[model samples]
Target: MTLLAESPVAVGPPAAPPADRMTRRHKLILTLLLGTQFMLTVDFSILNVALPALGADLGFAKENLQWVATAFALPAAGFTLLFGRFGDLLGRRRLFLTGMTLLAAASLLGGLAQSQEVIIAARVLQGLATAMATPAALSLLTTSFPEGPLRSRALGLNGALLSGGFTAGALFGGVLTDVLTWRWAFLLNLPIALLVLVLAPAVIRESRTPDKVRLDVPGAVTVTAGLLALTYGFTAAGTYGWGDPSALVPLLASAVLLTAFYLIERRAAAPLAPVRILNRPSVKWGNLGGFLAFGMETAVIFMMTLYLQDVLHYSALATGLAFAVPGVAAVVAGLGASRIIGRFGSQATLVGGLVVQAAANVGLLFLGTDRHWFIVVLAVLGIGFYGNVTAIVGFNVTATSGLPDEEQGLATGLTTLTQQIGFTLGIPLLSSIVAAGAAGYGSTTAPALALLGGIRLGVAVDIAVTVLGLVLIAVFLRRAARKNAV
Candidate 1:
């Protein structure tokens, strides 16, 4: 049977749930799910601000400090698809609870670690926990709420809190490190995880694919290895330059492994990612839109970070404070995104959001060394954050709307993978552009000017990429509409 055979159409707010059914119980379930999501996202960036303190306390070599973050990110990105499929085969609630348990243990271990190896090991466990939990939690959320304003609202809150968590991590990491210790950053997860463990079984329902399907081990292995290689390659490129063998070798390996995965999926009796699902116009275009939206937004944030610290010379605290504006904007956008999608439909919201984001990048082209320009920078970032959040919600709605409950895990997995890959690759790609732009200016150019030139170049590229994505999404969605009509 074709699992995702429905004609791909633009998703609008579907029929609303009965007023009585939309009760406090539903709200509690949403809070639990969103809280889980928030904790995972917070772990991604919480260590960044604490890196210095962590490295000093652990006696980490300067060159090896990146590993702390990389350890968590690599497994989180690489194993997500596999674990997502597992959630379908096993039970989502079971996997989710297990992941939460592991996360709590890992956090405790990391907080109490005395050596570098132990801390890195703990981070790896945490990464594994994230990989297992994310898609499971997401699939649960999507399945729990019926397709309509309810799901849109849940997704909007999900996107908003995801952004908020990253921002909060950075903000709180610094404060926690200064006031108490870096260990508290990891220890914080313990309580959150414990709370989820206590309440989840009571609120979240268990779900899995009803059909008994055999696992596609080859497909799983190849795709997991491929993603790992791909993520590691980009990360290495960010640190060691694109030309370095450390980046080149893995990039090449990733290409080969991913190709093998495609071939395996075509032949596998029960493919991890079904070909029919992937071939759907909504799934294909929606994911591409998500990839572009997330990649460019992350690239912009990295560039802005450099601009704030290197050219504008803001202290770390000052820079974090400045970004709080965008964080708040994301929350506001999240609050309103469902209403907008309900009114405009997902297609219009997605396209409009991308356009607004692109326009905001254009505004950043004017950012310069003058201190007064910081205001413009903040304003545009706030606008961009709002657009990004809205687009993210639209992406989630569009990509997963037509799929059956049995396939929700795979659908959520693909959406989650796009996000992780976008975050993994965005910085390196734009950093390369920035570096090339600066290098073209030669040695005699003022250091700050060269960096500024590079930042502008990166922003321009962000604008171009967003525009291209908008065009592609519009064209494909239009084509899908015509095909459905015929």
Candidate 2:
């Protein structure tokens, strides 16, 4: 993909603007694009606090309940690459508007769903909408802003909105579930989606790649099939234990499919992901960091929600309110990210953020059944969230820093793809660890202690994974920096 300033893609390239300074119109455009991103992210976690309520009301079995989250995440993670390239082939403005309309419709369907199958289908539709909108919206932002301070600031704010949306969704989901009905959680998206739909045509301009690129159908099929199989295997492992054929067969198939995907992409006429871009260290390591940043934070939210409601017996509203502090902190960190990156550099910001997150995970080890203990938990989570904000902003900037303008959609697609995959995989993997540990208590430990032990184990897994991410960033990113310097 090549994006030329003088590219033939646009019927009329947007009027040339001052290269460095942002205009009021630019700010409005950013707001509208970010709003769409926020909605997409919100749906990812909106169901977290509502899970229990939703399960009980819908008559979902305990093992089948996680599917509610997975159903949305799977399509979003698996199909984003195809949709991202689609946005470049088709008009981005058209795709963005269509996605919003579908998202609103899905939310309505979810609210009105009578059977579990209907609700799960609605969630899948929502995921498809997200897959379509996010890349288009992000590509629009990168093209609208030049690749400098203006772009860096925009990415930082976008990261902030993304994190804020997830945190806020947890709170809002709880409030709606407690005050009205769990169905309200889905219904709430209607107004926001409708509003974005109404205003989007005026604010967002259309953009696409001028040179026609054929879709890599074989590559797309293999990668999507691979991710689905992989995600399902992990989820099945959580439900049926690692020894079951239910888990092993899918895991093996995923391995074969993903291998085929790589081989196919290597030779495809128009690769779903270009080989050279995937080989860039900055792109590779930056996305790894991003995966950790998104994955662990989501796991934290899921675990905390379960801990507060299942063990501490907090109401949905209370659980949501508890997460507000950390959520606010995440926004602040996002807002300040450009300055932080300017002072410390993207590498430093990312590594430091991961370290802080690791420390916060350690702090979670002290959580007890007492509601008063949440004060400390929320405080520590705020600090961790701040780190997450910095890492998210820094990783995004680094990942796309050297890519050509034509590949902006691909870069952004890779970025969001890693995040969606993280959310899809993290919950089940971490939840399984907690469940396995909890089940092992076997009447030896007190039931309360056993549950707390499981929760602590979950926190420990988060810490270990985060530390591993920090190590990878330190080693790989530093090596890339040295290579570039030389």
Candidate 3:
């Protein structure tokens, strides 16, 4: 449970980048890493605003349009752990470069795609590229900066840029779709990926786990398939009913595959995810906190978007602009996160962040059809964003804090995996709740009123879940402290 304390186990000496001073080279390295983090995060939301335009131009069926987004999400969530292990086994820098190269190719293909099939293929490639890049980039960041204030600062910026990227993607996607074309949304990544490809090799040094362990092929295959099925199941449930075969079949398959993965890992000589690492309280509870933080945040935002567009009758561009203020708040939170963590510690900061987030959700219950409520919505979202960013940084710092140098990749992989899963599943889960709530309204109910009722119900559930997670995490940390004392 020593979530904040350094691990006693040191497989190898930690990387000694000038911990005392920040040099120009260090600045370059930090920029490269943070930039990559921002780009990857943006990919999650960039296509969302453009989906309509992209679908129309490419002849995508209305029912199948979700696949454009899901295609990218499935492989990204599914293969992240495997690629993360590959970073440890092969080379982090090597995997990063390969991912960037793939991203560039995928972006080009997507931008020029003339058909639905081609675009989906491009999206799948983009997903694969993200799977390879995200963990490698994160592990590189952790290794480059020795753990302490420096590492906390780097992670804070990483958290900030991540929130900023998601916000920007929505805003930029709207602008591009309106002014230029949906193709610009895909084309934008080409330059960013190329820049990273050119500069990363020069600035970042290659590092990997020192142990020459064999890859656990069975463990990798099972876990990858399990996660893919899990994500697909949730997505289908969101679109269709939970009891539908599309959702039920995948959910059942995920259960079986994940169980097999667990058993295989137990028996494997070199497990893909070591049981020892998974056993750590920080890794276990920290990731759970991460999952809730991301899942709830995403769900809240999705509902808010629906409220804006459906009830408030705002344009896509206007809705994007509305969220921009919160994005700025998140950036501010990220910039100040290190100071907050330094003063209060990761545990306290995380708890405080969750409290603020819960309070913000409570404020969102005041949302109504009145336009003046937009002011309240904006204010609460800003507060929520600030809390979410700090909590996210706290989760990252706590989860990866005590791990050995050799497992940094694995640790970062787990951190990012929870985030992707949270993002992928959050919307569907909350959307289903909202749908059910809306369906309960009588035929005499107004459409706006029914939608508003559904949104309120969903927000109430989100608040409760956030509170529950906060309590559980607090109890877990408190017990760990008592155990350490004993």
Candidate 4:
């Protein structure tokens, strides 16, 4: 999508101060970019509802059905930085449009797939295109909005889009998959993306640094391979029995590539990810906190949706509607985060939000058949509100604000990668815990309850981690305060 920027730089020069920058019509541009994010988000989980349809239509074995999801997620997770950096050096608008074009081709091809392998290949290409587009969308956002109120507002909208996408996807998936055709679900993006590609030229301006620098091709490839290996290894455990050669090989390969990635980043003149930006106090802790938060959050949603359908015997629409509560609350909280942070300080707002969410997880831990689902859903929605929007996206804005223009893309990439990693890792991690817990019990209520227990255990771990992160924020603040006092 074309970002209608005056210059090619991610963040254009400080235009005539706050007064002039306030007039920036980023709202319209973002409306289109977020449409892209929504489609990707929908596609990821929309398949969960349509898995049976896909299996029947495409004749996918139990082992390969997941590839439809993994193929897309892995490529997107693996290449955020690879493509984000390309946008920085090359041109975000160009990279953005090219990604949409590629994804459009893949999506149309996917709609016409006659074999499982062909469909999987299309999904992989689609993921790559998403990787290129998603980060570019975010980086363009950073550039389009100036550093303070505007940027935070823009990012808040992004958070809303993200939270809303998950709920919408599930709801639409059932309708599109059942009523029309499963292929239409995949085909939905064709028109939306085409519209974005067309409108982007008029609404969004192009942005890139004027400096000519060689592309960091090696760094991109190595890191991409490394992340793919890691995610592939983790996500494969479900189908491969964790002991299968396919699983072990990818996991081991990921370990090796990850080790190599660090070494390559250390020496590269034009690194895909700059190690230095990671050195910032806020940037480091913020990223650590963000990763854990998104990872646990994604896993929880996945588990809960299944529990409602498989165990609690709720219909797909009811399950989807239940999730909409949280989506709405997240939208409300996102709009308020900037104001809250300004009033309460970033540490207070962020730590306070995490603490409350830990409490919510504690509440969710006790949920079972005897309990009221409405109450449980309400608590979960409330928990989601402050926990998500105020934490990851807000922290990112604060952390990345300190970096240089060149490093902005890298900063966005690192944070985006962390979220993607969390999403990728969360699936298998939570699944293994639940599946293992179920296996320990017989084919009865005991096993089903055990799955709930596994979710509880997972949430407990997340609460502990969230608490630890909050404590770290506390320590980080006190130390900075003391240093300043001296």
**Tens-place lDDT digits, model 4, residues 1-486:** 111112345444344466424454565766777777777666666666666577789888865666777887788788776777677667888898999999889989888888888888888998898788877777777667766777777776776667567656666766676577778767887998899888888877787767666666777677789888877877776665578787789888888887777787778786656677766766777676666656766666777766776667665556666676766767777788777777876656656666666667767666777536656856675576557767755566655666655555566667677756776677666665665555556676565576677666666666676778778876885676588679
The per-prediction CA RMSD against the true structure, in angstroms, equals 4.1, 2.4, 3.5, 3.4
Could you tell me the lDDT of residue 328 within candidate 2?
95
Model 4 residue 70 CA deviation in Å: 1.2
Point to the candidate with the largest lDDT.
Answer: 2
Give one digit per residue, the lDDT tens place, for model 1 in 337-446: 98898898887788888888888889899887888888998899889989988888888888878767555555666888887667656766787678767766889999
Backbone clashes for every candidate come to 0, 2, 0, 11
Cα lDDT of model 2 overall? 0.82
**TM-score head-to-head 2 vs 3, winner:** 2
Cα error, candidate 3, residue 403 (Å): 4.0
List per-prediction Cα lDDT, in the order shown.
0.80, 0.82, 0.81, 0.70
Model 2 clash pairs? 2-406, 3-406
* lDDT minimum window of 10 residues, candidate 1: 1-10
Better-scoring candidate (TM-score), 1 or 2: 2
Top candidate by TM-score: 2
Encode model 3's per-residue lDDT on 374-431: one tens digit a residue: 8888899899989988998999898888767555555766787787777777766787
Candidate 2 per-residue lDDT over residues 109-145, each given as its tens digit: 9999999999999999999998888877877777777
> What is the Cα-based lDDT of residue 112 in candidate 1?
99
